[model samples]
Target: MSTSTSSTTPLLSLRGINKSFGAVHVLKGVDLDVWPGKVTALVGDNGAGKSTLIKGIAGIYSFDSGSYSFEGQQVEVTNPKQANALGIEVVYQDLALCDNLDVVQNLYLGREATSGVILDETTMERKATETLKGLSVRTLKSVRMKVSSLSGGQRQTVAIARAVLWNSKLVILDEPTAALGVAQTEQVLQLVRRLADAGLAVILISHNMNDVIRVADNVAALYLGQMAAQVPSESLSHGQIVELITAGRSGDLGLKAPDKEVVA
Candidate 1:
């Protein structure tokens, strides 16, 4: 696969992020960044606001306050299309595919290639084939096979191929390996790392500590809408990360509260 050298800047950044629903706050002053060629894992509990933060980034939900900047410029992303235009793509688990449609069809579903009113079958097929081949994803021979005929892992591959087709700069993947077997989980993890190596920043949210430890360059934990810690993967041990996830704090994690005088 072809690639460019590092450009020396973060592809995306979120600053002082906050989100609230009615009287409850979900994300409290969250700060995060996605550097090109790195996988940044966002870990948290069920209600730690990880999903909410992704929605705000994907434009599914508007933020109550804070900023999102891309390539050093702050812009408003009010809808999915706006986010798409900015080359920010989010791939969730469901593997959203049409069971009846073929791989080429799913790859170019809403935005199919065409010559006037006629579908450009030849062009679309060739491009889809090239994309899969480029990513070293060649588990299937026939692109015309329906989704129902493909295995779970193959279906996930199609979904990700579509994202890469869009030239996405920042891709957010939510529990990509949650439903697959051990082998399939490894398949998706390899794909995730390949995407980052191709220069697209990746944000992976998963409960599997092993997966995070295997692929993530940095880990950020969200505990009850607050950032418990954000540091390199080597800084924390396996048990330490798990402790922060379950109890919101871990003395062994080497994360000490900042010094502040409580009262005079």
Candidate 2:
């Protein structure tokens, strides 16, 4: 739970990012930094602009204004392809796997290896097996099994492994444990920690406070489309995180709190 990135430059930094839909403003001067080898949890209530912020990063929608810097260099990511080209991968809430497809098929769905106009099934299967093995994933019975027969945790693992197999620098997981049971959630959370341990920046978007507190190194709360605060998870209590999510700041944060309120 102790995530210290001292003396290390952030791998991804967003400065004053603004997004709007016609007359509706979604993000307002949002600023955030993601360090390699750490997990930054993005939490917010419904309509707090968490989704909008992530979409902008995912290149689903272009931000009306603001700056995006990856590895301290300014860049424009106009589409998911651009994001992927920059070593950014987003594993959405749905997991987006073809249920009927086997593990190797899902892993190499679109980017399968080919040999003289023929699908290289042997190579793809070997790569899939190696990828899972590299992640230290041992619970899977077989990488050739159809996704439909895998448990929720195994599916999540496969999705994450696929992202990592591409040499991704940053992996954004949206609600990874949302539909999973307790043990399954624990399994996915362990993989999340392993991701950071392997030196990849991880942005975990989840509404579950317990999971966030348990796995996140740093927690960034989004309030009304703005970044309320980004602090070490160990420095915040569950109630304080909820307070920031709901009110943009913790009301009980005496001297540490901002001085916007005057004591009568």
Candidate 3:
């Protein structure tokens, strides 16, 4: 994957974030930073609060307590619309495209361009074509093809392209390569790299360690609800990442043992 030094300023920064459901607290003082032109992988075991945290960031659920800042400006995100208006876009694992709709139609599903009182197919198609081109995506045969007929990789590309078409600054992809074959997975991964290369802050949520290591610039491990560490991907081996996820710390981050071992 192509890489650049992490920027001094993060495109999105969350400090001391918290979330809960009734009596259950899911997130505990989580801190994360996503820099432009880089992919930050969010990894944790099941029920480790990864999903809950992203939902809070996507504005599907409001964080109980935290400071959310975008490009250095503090702000509050209470709803999905607000997040979108602020250039935050999330493409979930489901790929939420209408099977019956073609790429062009799916791309402009709710927010179609209109001229006077008629749907402007020409302009919308042009925009979709340009967006895909801008991302250097060329896997689709035609933009008019039905989504159901596209391959897994092609479908993933369409969802990402749709998000980018809306002038998104931050793109959150949830398990983007899940259920894809090796070749398809590679195609999608390349697209992901291009997203960051194009200068968009990409938050990648994946369980595949190889994929994360290959494409991510940084990895943030969450054990339970707390951040175990947010370190450079190149600095960690797979074992170290696993240790952090399971034990909450590894290497120097882990607590030191006493000089003497206790006998049972």
Best by lDDT: 3
Report the CA-based lDDT of candidate 1 relative to the real structure. Answer: 0.86
Top candidate on TM-score is 3
Residue 235's lDDT within candidate 3 is 90
lDDT of 1 by residue, 13-40 (tens): 8889999999999999888877888888
- For each candidate, the alpha-carbon lDDT, in order, equals 0.86, 0.89, 0.91
Off by over 4 Å in 3: 254-264
Q: Please give the lDDT score at residue 229 for candidate 1.
A: 79
Candidate 2: C-alpha RMSD to true structure equals 2.8
Clashing pairs in 1: none
Please provide, for model 2 over 108-219, each residue's C-alpha lDDT reduced to its tens digit, 9 standing for 90 to 100.
9899999999999999989899989878899899988999999999999999988988989999999999999999998899899888887899999999999999999889
For candidate 3, the 10 contiguous residues with the lowest summed lDDT are 253-262
- Once model 1 is optimally superposed onto the true structure by TM-score, how far is the C-alpha of residue 135 displaced, in angstroms? 0.9
